[model samples]
Target: MGCTDSKDNLTPEELAIMNGELSLMYQAYQASDVDLVYRKYSNDGIININQWQNVSSKLKLAAYSAPMPPKIQKFYDSLKAENKYKLRDLLVIGIYLSTGKSIDKARLLFEAYDENDAKVLSKGDIQQMTSFIVEVAVEKTCVLIQDDDPNNVQPEEMAKFLQKLRTVKNKGKQELCKMFLGGNPALTELTMEKFVENVTMPSTVQLLTFQGVRKFIKKQEVTASKFAALTSLKKPTGPSDPKAELPKAK
Candidate 1:
């Protein structure tokens, strides 16, 4: 409800943030937009055992097993061992997993921002959630590159960049979470005017373009041998260029 607040008085920058067009924004910020099956499940805080079971089942079955966040794993283990818990707990667990935070951290966050006894997940939760996701993203990128080839320059460069980014504190993370919360409907006791006021400052927005993804790999980081190998692969050239082709009819 808060996310769709009237845009009549908002500035262009704020509008763009809420419109979900920011370059560096994470897909996780728009989790509900990409046809996730669990998006329909409501997070109201009424204690309901059946609802918790349903939510947990859906989350577990949604994808093939992979390493889950610690909190999520713990939540599942506890649920399996003893099927007694509050739906509120499960809702917080959902946010915890989605935002990539440990259960302890997420629980502490819930205590601070839970609008109504864990009934509502407020906008305050998005900041750390996004920060952790971004931190993890940078770390994962470095790890994957290092695993593939320890000598790769990209990973070293990326690690250095990540460290540099960290030096600025959580400024980037805060901006990202601002955009995330502004775009998402996870707010309580927060005013659109207040959000617009804070987000109006264009200087704070951080775009994680990473050479717009394509150039980051192909042009900037790809080894000559790898580039050559990629170029050598058979691929569709699409329709012939009309100007390069012989005149159809002489």
Candidate 2:
């Protein structure tokens, strides 16, 4: 079948058939894959009122779904009627419920968006959001593995251990040190791959997909590089007299 730029020419029957196609395009667009929409139709004019209604219905269903955590359920119930359906508000709460993130943290993530405006994210915004999620995941995994609290170490001690891990050049050595610090026999055999899996498949989330796994790995590499630079800066020089070396040059 041929594609058209305008939906005004299509009859109701045609619109019904096209609804499925439009729905998929809309979903992809919502997911930050606008390239797919452009490749297919090159414009948003084809979407009809029904598609908008469908999206709203789906969002409502997702937002009001049962078996939510008590905290989330209470928060949702507490929203004023007008605020309940607000896109940014629902989305902030939705992310908190879906990712097991604190509601305040999720709200902070969405703070860039206006409270009354529709929550439309640009490509750059999506990239920033993804980076934030990956950073959070990496930090959470490192903290879990370190288990610094049980050892009677202060929070600063745990931070130091993580700093030390970042400086370690060998991935294997990092994992070994993390395990030793954690003092968990069960995690003694845990590898980097296992840590990645654990972060991607937390108890509250089913699966984060290969993209999440890849991002986790890439984030770790960047973090290590950053810390390596800092570590190099703090390296001790040999016990040579700086004055002797400077005077010899003169």
The runs of at least 3 residues in candidate 2 whose Cα sits more than 4 Å from the true structure, single-residue gaps closed, are: 1-63, 66-68, 71-250
Error of 1 at 70 (Å): 16
Residue lDDT tens for model 2, 20-138:
22322222222222212222321222323333244434444322344543433343344335322333333322332232222233233334232233443333343343443333333
Worst 10 residues of 1 by lDDT: 210-219
Candidate 1, residue 119: how far the Cα is off, in Å: 9.6
Write the residue-wise lDDT of candidate 1 on 16-107 in tens digits: 32322222122243223211333345444333445544544554432123544343344244533254443333333333223232223233
How does residue 166 of candidate 2 score in lDDT? 42
All-Cα superposition RMSD per candidate: 19.4, 20.6
Q: What is the lDDT of candidate 2?
A: 0.34
